[model samples]
Target: MGVDFDWVILGILAAFIAYSLLTKAVDRSLLTLPIIFMGVGYLVSDPLRAAAPPEILSEGKRLLAEFTLVLVLFADASHVRFSQLKQNWQLPGRMLLIGLPLSLIFGTLAVYLISPEGGIAMALLTAALLSPTDAALGQAVVSSPDVPERLSETINVESGLNDGLVLPVVLLGAILASAGVSDANTDGLAIAALIQIVLGPLAGIAVGWSVARLLDLAQTRQLIAESAEGVVFVATAFAAYVFAEVIGGNGFIAAFVGGMVFGNTYRHHIRFIREFMDGAGQLLTMTSFLVFGALLLPDGIEHATASAVIIAVLFLTVVRMAAIWLSLLGTGLKIKEKLFLGWFGPRGLASILFTLIIMDEYVFANADELLACVSMTVAFSILAHGLSSTPLARRIGKT
Candidate 1:
């Protein structure tokens, strides 16, 4: 079969690149990359969308989402400041330990109330899927000089680690639900989850440690080139992810663990490496958002009830904020600061990727509902978070 879709992909990429360039030309604008890319993707796909195969679009979206996430996860985790983490452990500690679990609970409750059609298993799956935050979605806040370093650092660390930590829950939920879900059987999911959660970190440690040692050796021997130094970090990240998945481990966890280990061990090399991959990941993120807009948004809106949309808005506002309030009770942060932290837990890449795994597994029971909820929540997030980030940053930065 002669595939012409390659041309379509290239065209979309080129157009977005140009759009991004033009956006960069105009300074101090509310137009975010996600909004622009999403609008374009939606516009183009609206015409010729049905001409594309569902599987192909779905698979392509999943791959793009996966690549974006793996890169971002590694980059985010590797940049964590251990010294700061040591000092400010109370902040991130409260977030990951308390805030994360509460968010999971809130997600479950939200799903249960909003999507009454989905089974308990499905509710659990959706909850697990949305439990983790996406730092990439709020990159402005994290990367900005204006934002308080402590707050951004805490959020970044939470985003970097929570997704990996929640990996097993997402898998286990999917597995338990598989029995009644179309042709899926719940035979090996538990074992799969166990192996993945355990082995992913082991693989990451091996890859990250070995690469750090190798980089050091190369530096001592003067074997490193200017351009190729970046490759070492990139290669290590891809290696950790691919190796873990090849061995049936959780690649995302492997990448996250690998990034964390690499950053902590070889702190010197990571800044340059992160800079290189951050740019690449941004491009990938743009494309992922575009693809999501074109395909997933339409599907989400179609399948979603007005009630589901309302629940999604509520999920973004009340559910996450409440989780933050509870988690930060004793942190001594001002009410405004707590609210700032709460409002910024924007969901993006990881949630979408987790939801897509359901489709990849051909999950059949209330799959539509699950997909709808995931899509609606994420789409709402990309818009709401993207829009609010700048003004909120200005407001919070002043404090």
Candidate 2:
């Protein structure tokens, strides 16, 4: 019914055609799909932006980004084998419990130093926004045939769990960053965080267990539909998120936990679900980037200051690497392995959604600056990590 919709449809179609033509060339080069979509989004945005105005478009972009993440969280947790999680649990455990918090702490300090005038809350908001990593950003790193299985699995699980784990922190920071954030509102936010963290996993376990039992019954009776097979699996993924949100829990965390439980409880059925996601995931991930380039990144660039640009680069390099290195120090990992892990923490969809939540839900004096820093950070991450993914993976694999 509006302008941005038509433009996005055509733009994606055109991008696909161009992608088809350039597929071989891109595969042979350092160019990633995100880089292409983002470039196209920036180019076509001015004329094609929605007639509904700024706020509606921003909300639409946020929802698209959120949906992309929902699918990713569900798929990632479900895909990895239980054996892998049990064996390498310590790496990701230390990562989620120790490394992520350190990154936020160091990132907050760095941002506060960079912009002491922006206040502690603003710095916290910026660091919290930037802390989570995006596995999708470095698809080659996680999904490549050449990469070591344990290494890829480690990154996959770490990224999958971190997005949900970091939500409470981001929500707290956002509330504090709000202009008139009161003690009462802060108390309410803390309560919500507690519900999200605790209930999200519990609800996920309940839903995922239920879904597994239902699917088992269908399979035992040979009642599973051929035409609806994919749809059934897709429903399984969304069911976890919907169920959690309905019960005052965090949908993202539910999606991740539901996938883990669903996958393990019905390991035999995972293949069908993975097939469905493999087909749909690329489309969704690309669409999010396209919308990001056209709708979100431009606004971010408009608001960017020199300070934001510097902080963004610092995040991709110093902030993430230092945290990963410190956390992995006594884990028996080598210096190169540690550096490789550190260098690959690219920020993507999760960061976009977090920033959008701020823009939508709350108003702050330094909101523009916070978003600008996030936007710039993700944009740089796409390029820096995308180009380096293949080359670094090859080097690491050889090691």
Candidate 3:
């Protein structure tokens, strides 16, 4: 059989160049990229053309989203300064303890009231999935050194940590909702969840620390080459993920914790590793946005009901703001700072990943409704928050 190898290679190259060009445009107009790509997907889909295979679109989108989240979780965690985190642990602590749970509770109640077709458990699952904010999605806000270091650090740390912290809740909620609370294997699930949560960090620390020490020794012996350092960095992250998953731990958590431990333990090597992983992670994140546009958006839009739209809006604005307001009450932050921090907690990768995991692992009674709810919420967040992030940060700085 003759293969059209040249045509395939040319097409791949062309697509990459086109995507790179699109990235420049995306930087200029943050709101346009997702909206345009989404429109392209909708226009090109089977509804518009009967010849298009739906599964091709579906599978491609799902895979891109999964990989994107993994890279983002790792990169975000790696950039966190462990020393700074030590000094300001209270911010993240309050966020995980006070803000996150309240967000879930309020989100669940809001979904229940808004989604007439969704049950209580399903509502909670939806809430749990959307509870954690994504710092990567709103880099403008979280990365602004113009903002108070304390505020930025708090949001950054919370965004990095809360995503991992909320994984067990999402898993538990999905299990209870999908398998039926009575029939669910809570004991086994709980044990597995605990192991995944606890072991993920331990595995990351052990692997990252050991590798850092080995690299240090290798450098002392003049055995470590410049190129090999990059390889070691990638290997550390990959090993952390694979080993944790092999033991039924959370790979995302492992990647994050591993990156953190590696960053801390191997501060000298971090410049090399962080740059490579971050570039790789950005590529993955962009691919994710494309897939999200192509696959999730179209289906989510078709399934979107009035209830779904209302819930998405409420979750993005009212529910989240309320939870943040309550969480920051005694923290002594100014009113402007509180509002700025609260409004900027954009939900992105973690929600997308958790939703994908739920779909893969369990069959919810209202799968479509749950998916629709999460998808709409995420889409809104990416757009609404992406557009306002820069301006909002500037405004906060002025105030």
Question: For this target, which candidate reaches the highest TM-score against the unseen true structure?
Answer: 1
Residues 122-163, candidate 3: write the lDDT tens digits: 888899998889876677777776677788878888897788
Best-to-worst order by TM-score is: 1, 2, 3
**lDDT comparison, 2 vs 3, better candidate:** 2
312-351 in candidate 2: lDDT tens per residue? 9999999899999899878888888888888989999888
Point to the candidate with the largest lDDT. 2
Q: Candidate 2, after superposition: displacement of residue 121 in Å?
A: 2.5
lDDT of each: 0.79, 0.81, 0.73
Query: Where does the lowest 10-residue lDDT sum fall in candidate 2?
Result: 179-188
| Residue-level lDDT tens digits of model 1 in 138-219 | 7778877888998888888888788877877887788777766666666776777799889999999999888887887777
Model 1 is weakest, by summed lDDT over 10 consecutive residues, at: 23-32
| Candidate 2 clash pair list | none
Clash count of each predicted structure? 0, 0, 0
